[model samples]
Target chain A: MKRRSAIALVGLTLALAACDNMANQARRNPYELPYGSQENWPVMPLATAVARDEPLKPPSPPPVTMALLERGRQRFDINCSPCHGRLGEGDGMIVQRGFPRPPSYNIDRLRNVPSQHFYDVITHGYGIMYSYADRVEPTDRWAVAAYIRALQASASASLADVPPDKQKALQ
Target chain B: MAIFTPRANLFMNAALIGAVLLGACLLLAIRVVPVIGYNTQERFAPEQPIPFSHKHHVSGLGLDCRYCHTKVETSSSAGMPSTAICMTCHSQVWRNAAMLAPDRQSLAENIPLRWNRVYTLPDYVFFDHSIHIAKGVGCTECHGPIGDMDLTWKARTLYMSWCLSCHRDPAPHLRPRDQVTTPDWRRTPSTPSGEALMADYHVHTENLSDCGVCHR
Candidate 1:
């Protein structure tokens, strides 16, 4: 009976050990590996060049379109929503306690920023935001930028957003 | 009749060993020697709608390669000298020449010169001329030597294996930014050793072997 009990205990211990190993693996790769620019450039802790003095020239291929915005919305919901929050208010559960609280997308500073500026920030990453270059294609970056604009517009839109005909219908 | 022949047996064994060694060396040489100059001569030949000659334009007139292929440093596709860019010189110089007939035909037909692509990589390989040039990988890193040739063909095999040779470790081919477009650029005294340059640039080799890189 003692030998049988010992054998049972050993089996339980092995099962728990395997469970713990699986839990660790699940925790290690929560998202994709290497989420940003892999270059070993010097990360200036608190670099003062946060805002540019002069305006950046236009983006290489130019501005985002509505079609791009719709595509961007899909990509954002898939990739960004898990951490950035569905509404982009930075209230994602992971961020509420300890994970980096990504800035809200409705902020005027980022909303008014040039599309290419947003593209660069997403591609190269700024602050806690990891670069999405590997996961997102170049054109999709523009799409994401468009979706951010749509989100900003939705958040800020007033009754004035409705046309006069639509206003009459509401009345 | 007088053959107590242990000495003769030893000599025959040595000759057999020598023959095997020679055969192995010859097989290795035959496989390797053909690959040495395979990509160099073919990639530098000239081809265009007008049959423009690098020998006539560059070697004969001593004109710079950059003067025509202006975006070779700045953009990809070497900007495929637009019809307007070509007509800038050809209009004034070769206006009445019989050899210039094809150039006139293309311009009249509104067909851009379908210059045969000489150096091409498989579509899956993302070879950014800008990034490579920016990081100081020279034109000849893949194109061999173009300034001396009169025609163009595939200079490098441009196979994934060829790219991996440099990508796995690009320590022997890095040069300065100015030397990036220089056709005759090679690993010379002034050039930074490829290893030091890759280190300075922080180009990681951990993912260099990843199939997704070249394949996707």
Candidate 2:
């Protein structure tokens, strides 16, 4: 009889454990809200002609000023350099390890592409690029955009390549 | 006896006043301190998976935020960008520099940078970006003035209470659809109050404020 009581007590404990687990599962399920519920948002009127084609304005010219580049460089190091190499070589650490490689900016195809395309990609996040919308401000994204242009120019530049106005400014 | 009584009364009155004043101040700090809710600090300066900055891209170069973070209106997760995006330009730029350490590491190591999230909702909360964007919510409504910030900070407390306050009545925050992308788009003569718009949509405020609407 004593042995039977021990077995019954064990069964009761198992039943209680099962009950507790079910309760916890219910709580956990409640916390994870379902995805793709469309009806919750308030109705907003459709917007016509948002800036889809027009490219965002570029940043002010860099005089190769370290103070300016330092800010750009620091930000690049923190954000862009991780994916784009420090020299903007498209050899960013992420690329070498099996991630899709981005086109080199100096490539004729990319160089020929309008700057607006780049800006749109940065804002909206193209194939693999995530949106920096939450991470970087609008203007700062422009700054990085400008810095990127500068990096591209630096990589492909020759001493004879300086623009006439920039040559005089350097003198 | 009279002198003792007066002294005791003075001491008692002073102590009571001090206690009341202290309590009032504490209450005010909690209640009246300008739109501050709990978790404000965490939202204010969050650590991201990667240390990204807007100062360089926007302020320095005048780039729009939309250029990189595209899917604000269409997708749920404004999807984290992959390395291919960075290499698009980095390939031919800055070939050698100390600044490209992380980029280089990511390329060499074959590891993706793990970015920390800045704006996160409780697991129970359901937020749809497309609907909000479709209905004329601009990035700034929920994100605040990101164009102006050098460092990314949580501009608004995205708690259910905060969301409901706007949902039940969005008149104060509503602006024209054209002004959605304009970061500084303030409500003008042309703009309608959230109540007026809600009336147009026939949104019921009675159950609209229900917790399940946003919570689940």
Candidate 3:
């Protein structure tokens, strides 16, 4: 009788296994609401992360290279160009859609500001802008500041500024 | 002997054949039904609190995927755009659109807007978006022509076999990391060959197909 009961139990478990899905299990996932939290709003994960072995305050470093500029351009185009525009003209799509127009990088005051000023603004947003400290990294912020300088430079750069060989490509 | 008619042979044969045919039908049904049952809805767009158009936002405005899905390159979960992110434009553009009433309400109430999920994997699957992205897989490779999609739908069934097909040979799907979020990216002649990219991205296929890679 015990043997028969044991066989029946095994059969029951096998049948149950057919219904039990390993997929779509009931465990908590990322971005799901925290369990029984009182806050009505969506609780976001902490986004303040530093680069490996980096200091709390990363000053805009020097020895900027072509690679650094390229990285800066990519990160800037993704993060800043949405509102600041690709050319830093402050005429981004979001601005066209009606967000407050940010000052163009070509403005004299902005042109005069140090690269550190741009880095600080990105870390702690300027008026009407939210802090992008969560999105843009410390190193990338310097890259962006450098790219802004490049944009400002390009706005006024003559054919003489372009390398003679590559100048034909521009034409 | 009289009870056994000649027609009894025919009846017995018919019964045996019918039983075998029924079993075959059952087997076919078992194999076929669930595939259709589950995968049928995957292609169809589900109802959402807001009818957000990827075509309008992505294709029309030319916003980068990282503009909203900020954590795609860094985290496993491609983070959803918060209500504030929506308001960055809507607060100025469509401040009073009836369609955005839910968004307004959620923001005012300080409650989360429940966006319906489009691509929920089986809980056991530990798929990392960042890793695939770092390995040079473009958004279009998995998500399909997202820029063209008006309402998002699942492009592929996140089936194990489908995953293994890519994990076994990841080269064909790779792009330059710069073009990872580009919706219309196609490999040009200048683009490196798959073998070169496999070396470049450090993708070792030898253990990619192992069960523990995903199950754990």
The number of the candidate with the highest lDDT is 3
Superpose all Cα atoms of candidate 2 onto the true structure and report the RMSD in Å to 1 decimal.
Answer: 15.9
| lDDT, candidate 3, A25-121, per-residue tens | 6666776555445364465535885456566667547668998899889888988898899999999988887788999999999999988998999
RMSD of each: 24.8, 15.9, 3.8
> Per-residue lDDT for B1-216 in model 3, tens only?
599897999999999999999999898787776567365355777789999999999988888999888889888998888787786677777889999999999889867678888888877889889998899999999898889998998887777888999999898999888888998998899999888988998999999999999988
lDDT of 3 at A3: 100
Residue B20 in model 3: lDDT: 100
Please report, as a residue range, the 10-residue window in candidate 1 chain A with the lowest summed lDDT.
A23-32
User: Which candidate order results from sorting by lDDT in descending order?
Assistant: 3, 1, 2
Total backbone collisions for each predicted model: 9, 60, 0
Interface RMSD of each: 28.6, 11.6, 2.0
lDDT of each: 0.64, 0.62, 0.85
Q: Which candidate leads the pack in DockQ?
A: 3
DockQ of each: 0.01, 0.03, 0.61
- Off-target runs (Cα >4 Å) in candidate 2 are A1-171, B1-18, B25-29, B32-39, B47-51, B58-66, B94-97, B159-161, B175-179, B184-207
Could you tell which candidate, 1 or 3, scores higher by DockQ? 3
lDDT tens digits, residues B1-216, model 2?
365765798899999999999999999887766455444543475665445666554454444444454555566655555554454445445546455567667767665545556676654566767666656667788887776665678877765567877777766666555456565567767678767766765556678677777654
Q: Could you tell me the lDDT of residue A70 within candidate 3?
A: 90
Cα lDDT for residue B134, candidate 1:
68
Would you estimate the TM-scores of all the predictions? 0.43, 0.47, 0.85
